[model samples]
Target: MSAVPAGSPVRTGAVVPVLASAGITVALMQTLVIPVIPELPRLLNASAGATAWAITATLLAAAVATPIMGRLGDMYGKRRMLLISIGLLVAGSIVAALSSSLVPLIVGRALQGFAAGVIPLGISIMRDELPSDRLGTATAQMSASLGVGGALGLPAAALLAENISWHALFWVSAGLGVIILGLVLRFVPESSVRSGGRFDVLGGVGLSFGLISLLLAISQGADWGWTSAPTLGLFAVAVVTILAWGWWERRTSEPLVDLRTTARPQVLLTNLASMVFGFAMFAMSLVVPQLLQMPKATGFGLGQSMLASGLVMGPSGLVMLLTAPLSAKISAARGPKATLMLGAIVVAAGYGVGSILMGSVWEIVLVSLLIGAGIGLAYGAMPALIMSAVPVSETAAANSFNTLMRSIGTSVSSAVAGVILANLTINLGTHTLPSQTGFRTVLIIGAAAALVALAIAACIPTRSPTPTPPATPASAEAPATA
Candidate 1:
């Protein structure tokens, strides 16, 4: 593949589409079950709390698996790890398709989530393979794939669940995975750029435990009660574990994450912006659906069905698809930092306008579209910014860490939004639902988070000229290549 030379379009364009498709497949898993969540208990003969594990399992698995797989890709071949991730998705989907009980379903779901490393892996592959001129557009599209798959998947899953056996959902997911796997094998080239290392076994275990504890507490704290012992205990353990992990990473010869490079202001600030942007993007997703489906009798609600609400939000994904290339263009001319700041402002404006426009379905749809466009712009810039600062050998690990930050942001948004909607509700006779004020509060929070990202983006110094020297393999077992 390196035969295409540095600027060859054929070499650059050939890999991006398949890699992006793989990315979309990974993101689709996040929303595949949303339409069936309410019916899970009745369908599986389980309690609501027990059924909730299907979602939680995926979240936990993704948080732990993303960075680990990224590190593995750096040590191994990027294409090899990418294919492995896709294989896990297919296997998990097939297992879920065959399951009737909650245990098997949760197990399969977690397995599916284990494939969450694909997005970062794809981004890293692009960095290694694509020409610098093509890199921005290609990476941006890869980043937008996360939202595109999610937005498109919701309505598709809803339609499938409503029209056919719910098992069809998993089967279809499996089919998509298989198709993607084949496409990846046929078109995507294996990246030669390797950041080979002695995989830090203890550090990996510590980081995984730390992430699980922290994310679990954040995700479940609202359900378990914020002040509960289990929640507090998990939070405390997470802090200590994470601190220890950092200490170990700093000392280890072949660290899982390059703490020194990550400490640079550019990478640090870019990751910070990604987290806040993730938070801001999720706010629209959480609020718009609730606002649309709530009864119009509540005066603020649009009273749409779940399917209708999904349809209303589906167009946003298309907006993201269209905006990604434009974002890349802006980044090429003005720098990714400028693009990121622009995206932040646009997102903040989306929320500000959306708060006032909640009276109609079109208005809400417009808001989702606006937010999606901003997300596309910001998301596209992130990989470009990260790849610019990190070494070729550490590309996958750095990208994976950025993806993890986004996940952290989304998890916090879910917990925070859940709390606001829960407490700030209106009682209507025998029924209680989140008040319009609660929805407004969440939108405002989204705007504030975007503005915070904007400020952080401003702090990222304009793109630097410093270059990473080629690697002398990380260890005796590692490859000696870029």
Candidate 2:
């Protein structure tokens, strides 16, 4: 594996769009089943608890697979791993579309989750292939694709679920995946940059177990009793496994993740900032839709249909896409640290405003746009920060780890919001709903999380010094050393 010549000619117009489109296609998996969640028990002829696995399986699989796929991409080829990931997504969609029961649906969702590595891999590809002039906006667009797909998927999925069979959702996903796969094969070049090494099998297993235990506890703690044996047991296992995994990583010759490199202040602080920003960003996704769909009798509720709520939220995704260029400009001019801090401030302000303006649909849309802009700026800057701090060979792995941090943050955010909403519910004719106070409390927490991210970002170096590769046998196998 050797580095692509820096001077290799790239068709920027074709490469960027293909990669970004692929990224969006992968991201659409996250929200693809949301519209069918409430109806899952009836549709699948299973308990709600079993049906929830359809969503949980995806989250757990994604968390476990992201870092592993990234390492594989580095060792083999980014484009190859990327293609495999997209293939899994397509296969998953087809399986899900064809499934008539809960078990196969969960399996398909888990397979779909394997595509989580696509965005980070796309960013790495951009770094390897794009000219410096095009890199910033290109990565920005790729990063924003996550939000773009998620926001857009909600409305699209809602329309399909409303008008046709719920299975149509997966069928459409499979169709889109096929189209994206073809475009990727045609347009995206395999990066010559590679970190050739044996995969760390034990390290990967350790990480997967730890992450699975931790996320399972967080995501399911609300439904399971918070203090139940299962929740506590999973949390304990996660802590012990992660601690032991860290010990192993520190000593392993060719570790899965180079903990030494990750411990660098620039990398460490940027990752910390990413986590809190993820926490802040997810609050809107959890809160606004509920506010929209709650019955009008709830006083603050707007009483909108799921489709209408999705339509209102839809603009926020477009805002993210539209702001990518602006985010890139800010990062290029002031450094990614500044861009991240600015984004945090904007998000905090958005939440602050949202805490006050829960009265109407238009106000919710305004809040959604504000937060989306902030998340767009923050998300766009993260890859720049991570790539700047890590060696080229470690690019995908570092970015994937950063993404895992954000995922952890969102899981925790969901747990915390669930607890608050559950505890502070108002009764409305045999139904329990989150009170205005609960929503406001969640908004305030979101604002506080954004400020915490800003504080963490402030600690990141204004410019990361070029990192030296970790002292491992694998370092010699990297294109830089080769």
lDDT (CA) per prediction:
0.88, 0.88
- In candidate 1, how many Å is residue 142 off? 0.2
**In candidate 1, what are the lDDT values of residues 1-482, reduced to their tens digit?**
22222223334456888888899989999999988999999999999988999999999999999999999998988788888999999999999999999999999899999999999999987877665667778889999999998898888898999999779999999999998888777677676567565899998999999999999999889989999999999999999999999999999999988898889888999999999989999998899888989998998999998889899989998888889999988988888899999999999999999988999988998899899999999998898888777777878889999999999999999999999999999987899999999999999999999999999999998873222222233431332121
Q: Each model's TM-score?
A: 0.94, 0.95
How close to the true structure is residue 166 of candidate 1, measured as C-alpha lDDT? 79
Residue 320 C-alpha lDDT in model 1:
88
lDDT of 2 at 1: 28
Candidate 2 lDDT score relative to the true structure: 0.88
Range of the 10 consecutive residues with the lowest summed lDDT in candidate 1: 1-10
* Residue range with the least summed lDDT across 10 consecutive positions in model 2: 464-473
| Tens digit per residue, CA lDDT, model 2, 1-482 | 23223234567789899999988888889888998899999998999888989989999999998999999988888889888999999999999999999989999999999899999999988887777778888888898898888888888999999999899999999999998888777777777678887899999999999999999999999998889999999999999999999999999988899998899888899999998888998899899889999999988889999899989999999999888888888888888888889989999999999999999988999999999999899888998888877778888898899988888898899899999999999999999999999999999999999999999999997783222322233452443221
Q: For every model in order, what is the number of clashing pairs?
A: 0, 0
The root-mean-square deviation over C-alpha atoms between each candidate and the true structure, in angstroms, is 3.5, 3.6
List candidate 2 segments past 4 Å from native.
1-8, 464-482
